[model samples]
Target chain A: MDDKDRELLRILEENSRLSVEEIGSMTNLIPAEIEARIHALEESKIIRKYTTVINWEKAGNAEVSAIIELKVSPERDFGYDRIAERLSRFKEVRTLRLITGTYDLQLMVSGKNMQDVSRFVSEHVAPMDRIRETATHIVMKSYKENGNTLFEQQEAERLPYSF
Target chain B: MRNFVSDRAREIPPSGIRKFFDLVMTMDDVISLGVGEPDFRTPWNICESGIYSIEQGVTSYTSNRGLQTLRDALSARLASQYQLKYSPDDEMIITTGVSEALDIAVRAIVNPGDEILIAEPSYVSYAPCVTLAGGTPVPVECTEEDHFRLNPDKLLEKITPKTRALIINFPNNPTGAVMKKEDLEPIADILSDKDLLLISDEVYSELTYESSHTAAATVKDLWERTITLNGFSKAYAMTGWRVGFLCAPKDICDAALKIHQYVMLCAPVMGQVGAVEALRSAEDEKTSMVNEYRLRRNMFVAGLNKIGLTCHVPEGAFYAFPSVRGTGLSDVDFAERLLKEQKVAVVPGSVFGRGGDYHLRCAYAVSRKDLSEALTRMETFISGL
Candidate 1:
């Protein structure tokens, strides 16, 4: 039953629009089995929201993305998580990873253009209380983003099983 | 939102070699041969050109492809030295060093699930870049028997229908093996036959003391399928300047140039000036350094051999890849012991690829005095072990 949930999660990742029957066929399971597994996976928060994976370049958005590394200091009482919560409220923060390096937080922020990005950094990211220093790399380009996903068997081993 | 992560992110391990170096940095009296970079500063002539460019205010971004003069100089130098010809305007891009050129090469060509054939125990970037580009990195582990050269037969064995490109880096990092024309021709033919592209990194091209560097484009038919990456970093001692050029057919160059432009409007405008000067005035710097490196290479190899550490006489580049097999330890474990016990910092071969389990790379580009001290420390460390 857990293996089926892992399969359902993987299929959903590959194509969020996969129908119950199509997913089961792809995973070599019956439709009724797929429906039950998908329901369970979705209920468990493994399959989050179905998202439209648009190739932004092809979508005519021409949005310029930039990465800004921040050295933020949360208030004396509040910890880093509280500061992260405040920052994530901005619509532009795509992904933020609290890194273990010279910089405390690496923000994958993007905006329509340099002006919009600069506005966000100066007004919001930079002025945050206790931000020691901010280094903006403006991800000139990423030849490759991390595309490594564990194979299905490995994924199954990683997850807890009830059955 | 576009995915920030991909499937390959989870497949391979983070660079253990880099991690070890970070750990060893805190240790005292470690004679470390572990850092992969060279020891020299940018040549004086190159530095002058850079200063002059800044003084002249050539600071604004140049054309996306790069400065016309630098590109022409690179093309002329490549043709004169290596018998390769790429049109400066149509087929070259000035990038922010070979790192960026490599990034563009992988991104411009590879699609998800494609396979990248790498001659292992070679350059470190080939596999990680391939994984990041959503391609499978199939390492064709070259052995000490091959002097770490990519065997054309081995390359053929690694190719499947899904294979996309073969990454070739000669005067190779860690191993210092340079592939001569005679050695590369068969691989070129293979590329032609297989309809595969070649990402040839020859950043150390000028540093070869052996036969002349072989450009992949020197092959009659492989020019279209070859993307050549070279830089002033290794040969001209311009590592910090971060200037590299990528040359390929116009279409591929165009695609890479788009990414190059967006990423770096130009290779440090000053670095371009330095590259032009390095090509124009520093024939002596290349020869003199190669001569010094050859001397250091001999000293390093002999020292290792005397201490019962076996080595392949590195044909090019500044690294001496020697085996640590006698120590009864894994390459990583041996490197740790060496750094902790002897303070000799050399990168473990395992960081490069499999079959590197018994080896380590010692860069001999440091001053002869430092090299001598390092050798002494290494010998003492090994003897104690």
Candidate 2:
């Protein structure tokens, strides 16, 4: 994409709710041009979705999260992709990846509480036929997530002067 | 109340750039290309020094010439970078930014009715500072055809028996015109023959793009007469620290320091501590900033030309002095209407002196996104015009 397109993507990534006119003034494009570009980006799926980053703890939805490393036995000729695809279908899995060193796959799963997460790991994950061993790491507290700090961002006051 | 003001204070007009800035300040969502300072924060190490000084209870005023270590660092930096020598102890006085240095330098040599020649379309403060010092500021016009280089022949014509000094800023503000070593040779040759002193403001010296800057003081015989003023403000993003230094022959420095001693006791201790750190650690940071500025300059200048506004590629500093004459608007009218209509703010060039009539000064020391956006708005605005 061109510089203008890249800039528009960055601005939208920061605040998706900004209006076409606002984006137009910021990017030097007219509102109609901004509208057309945004439309093209959306149609092409370059802009996947407009989503909010909510503070779940502040929203009173405290979740128990854990990263579960699994040793999986891949079927002949299918490799690890077949098992990875199957693991991604579970509602409990927030993210899944095939990792190197000791583990064939890693899954980040979340539930309402510790008991709920443990039950899912034992009943669903441990019983799977291809799953050989599982190691679960429960997250006690999250200081940072998704490139944002859990605490308030510090704003240092700048001293102003004429050069 | 009006009568209580000094005549010099009353006579000097309020800065034209400041007037425009005041208007722009009240308006929201204006993409400004008018700031003269770097957009970056002071480097962390430099800021840490200032913080450390505060924590260590180094809150008292520093020596009138600033910390010896800071002066020593500045001395070594000047020697190493520009090959110019100054004794830190007797030939340099740290002032409250380049503004103060310029002020005190003018006061040091200029007597009442003395003429100080300044190239047109330069920094806003030079003339007012001269005027405030009871000196007449003579405007020596430097045009776009000359790439805004001060013409030696033209400078000769402006010289009079009353002329005490010629003040110049290379990699100049408002215009961003820079002179190479060869380009400065002729000017140096001309000035060497003249009796007038040379006051060179090299604050933007580090922002040079294509080639390294040649300090006016470093030219063959001009060292004794040239008062070179520089600071960490532009180079290290330390504007608010109120730190700058003036280097000259011992006599002039002694005189300037006397004025500095009374007018302002000393530079801030924290700022002095920070300057020592900046001088020690900020070379790489300055180089990286200059590289970023170079990129922005290329993008903005090309963008301006592509959009039909003609801007000569500025070789130094962060400003692009683009001619808006093609659009048939006066610089003031162009700037005002652009701000009012397109939500973009820039300074009119006319305030810089005689040769600045139909141009606008666009500072590129802003974010790449903002520069791009501002250029787009300017294109649209000019097209509408």
Candidate 3:
């Protein structure tokens, strides 16, 4: 992507709700050009999905999240990819990664409650093929997520006017 | 009993921005575009450096000329950026802020009855600073017709036998006019023959969108007489830290230093530590902030034009000087009515000085949401007018 496209991405990443005309003004591009570039980026999957960062707890829909570490045997040619793809299809799996060190795979799993998450881990994740050991760490709190602070943002207490 | 306030202090008018500030304070949800400061906090790394210094008990006063390390970094930066050289030891002194630097620069250079020519529609403090230093501030008008860039002919017209110096700021406050190298060449040529010194306040140098800023001292024959003032306030978002640098020839530097050593002692050590870190590694953070400002300027200025407030595109600095003459109201009336009617705060341009009439100084240093909302309200207000 060009610098202008990158700039447009950065702006959208900060606030996806901005209109095309607003983006055009900010990027110094015409509406048509912005639309064309954004269309191209989306077609290439570079722009990805536009999503909102919501504090579910504030919305009265608190959920439980846990990091599950799995030790697994890599099957011949498929290695870890085959199992990773199978685990990715689960609705409870928010994110999955093939990690290094002691863990062969790490998954961020979320559910309606701690018991629900534990049930998912015990029933579905633990009995997976080629799995050796599974350990789940329940996240007690989230201070930051996806580059956004979960807590209150610092308010700059500036005077109403200054030189 | 004799009057307590001295005549110099008494004669200097209060800041024009102060009245609007008091008005804004009483109002609720006023989307203010009046303040000339960045909305961002100091970058995290820079703040961490200052905090680290304080945690390590480095809270004492730095050297009277500020930390040698900061001066060294500043010296190197000036050399690399503008090809201007100054000895860190004797030719540069850190001050509380550019406000203090400008104060001392005027105090050090002005003798009684000396006239200092200032470009009009400028910062509010320049004239009063000269007046308080017992000098005459002769305003050389820079009109909107010329996009507020200081003209050499107008500058020359204000020069007299009593003239001692010329004070200039660009990208200018209130107007956002920037002087490129070519624009400054003739002014440099004019001063090359005269005995006048140039006090260049380059606080907004890093905020230029169109081209890189050209330091006045870098011009031919101007380095010998130009006193450069800059600070971390605007670019680094460290206004509260109050670290500024003054660079000049040794003689003038020493003169300003003498006043600085007595009145201020030194800039805070913690802030100087942060400034060093800013110069060392905050380039990416600075560039990101400037880019954001450029974006905001484009959007806000275009929005103003679409709303029928005809604003000149500001090449540098965050302010948009939009004419309110189309509404058939004076600048002050326009500003007051806008604040009262629409709850959008902007400074009246006339407060800046001559040639500022019938214009409004709207700073684009706020968030895009607020800027958009303010524009909508302003459009409604204008349509109703």
Candidate 4:
């Protein structure tokens, strides 16, 4: 909304776990100001839910993911919006987007295993009324996700002390 | 066997904190607040440009003054930022790093026994570099009372018939002090009366938090006499790439270039390529990194004060020099005891030179988590003391 608000967003986007006092110190704002600003941002839906980026494989809960591209015929009045809304209701769909270049819609979906994801695509996704064709590409690995590197980030190697 | 080392080399004392640094290396789990470099890697685009240059077989020695395009970009940047005009073809030479630039600037200007006035509690290399260039370095103490700025009277006191040059760095390394235009005007006035050169190390110029840095060359009547040295190390976090610029009057630059040509030839071609990209496109990345440093400085300096160590908010540079006198310990003792008891490594301020006693230089270039943890450990250590 403003430069200070943008700066606060950038800082929070980088590390949302920072305490109000810590964020206040960094932004040169008092704790009360930071609290009120954060509240306003949340109420305005500018500040979304704070979430963690977990490496599920490391946590021994590895999940299978796929990117589904949908080619759909527009309904008489509803167009792609009806089908998009229907796709969004699926809990397995982590992200849904209207995409350009050879796809009308893209769905990022994940499930407990490859079979589970395939079953969902075959049984539910392709049989939709307006859904004409479906293509699912199973993701093999995630090197980066949600602006975070999925691998162990390299530490800056430096001497303990230097001039 | 006869001593092989020259008198000049022998006379330059080893860093007093060498043993302390060695001790730091031997310890485990030490959160170091002692480094003088940025923690960020070189921006991705800059690195990609360098790699692309190498991949495309652009690896060859650049002209003795570095690539023309980089020099051109630097010239335009200087002119636009400071209104200082320099010919890229004649008045600029890219060197290995600011370290090399400073070394050549000193060698090119200093004659035997010509005294060079260096502000104390400065970067450790300044005095030694002057001595290695066959110049006697006179220390002009910048005290805490003066906010570690070089007072004009002090500068005047140090100048003499033999005084050949004065070297100044702002957004200074150890003290993190900066000189705004008003603060520098008096020093410029003093220099205007003397037949002295000014070697301005502006490597930390972009790191200023409160105000934009004032280049010494931009000061009144100082341009003709000032040798401005800067590089991509601090601002762009490309220290390992080692690209630096030296800009001055054509005659001074010519002299420095001759030495650079014979000794170093040119900066690495890949680095020069990366530098061109950095100047052309890395503004956004540089700004974000600087903003991160500012945030860390505010938080860490406040944390230091909150923990009862009196620290002046550093207006520039990454270090927070706080007085450890209240804890009844010398800076060296403070550093050593803190390291041994708390696993936190900080540089003792006395190693930086005069007016640094009982002070500890803590670099806030580390992450916020590490800084917070280090502060907690330091609080426990101080309370026990």
Best-matching candidate per lDDT: 3
Q: Is candidate 3 or candidate 4 better by DockQ?
A: 4
Which stretches of candidate 2 lie above 4 Å from their native place? A1-163, B17-19
Rank list by DockQ: 4, 3, 2, 1
- Runs in model 3 deviating more than 4 A are A72-79, A129-132
| Deviation of model 3 at B230, angstroms | 0.5
Give the docking tier of candidate 2. incorrect
lDDT of 2 by residue, B15-59 (tens): 676666677767877887877888898898999989988999999
Winner on lDDT between 2 and 3 is: 3
The DockQ for candidate 4, computed on C-alphas, is 0.80
lDDT of 1 by residue, A1-163 (tens): 4655654564466567756654443344677877777777778786767776545654677677888898877566767888888788888998888888888888888888888898989998898787889987675544434442222322211101000
Cα-based lDDT for every prediction: 0.78, 0.87, 0.92, 0.92
Off by over 4 Å in 4: A74-79, A153-156
lDDT of 4 by residue, B122-228 (tens): 88999999999899999899989999998999888888899999988897889999999999998988887887889999999989988888998988989999999
Least lDDT summed over 10 consecutive residues: which range in candidate 4 chain B? B16-25
Q: What DockQ does each candidate score versus the true complex, computed on alpha carbons?
A: 0.01, 0.09, 0.72, 0.80
lDDT of 4 by residue, A112-162 (tens): 999999999999999988788899999999999987888887676897877
Query: Model 3 residue B20 lDDT?
Result: 72
TM-score, candidate 2, first chain = 0.88
> Where's the lowest-lDDT run of ten residues in candidate 2 chain B?
B15-24
| Better candidate by DockQ, 2 or 4 | 4
Q: Distance (Å) between predicted and true CA of B342, model 3?
A: 1.7
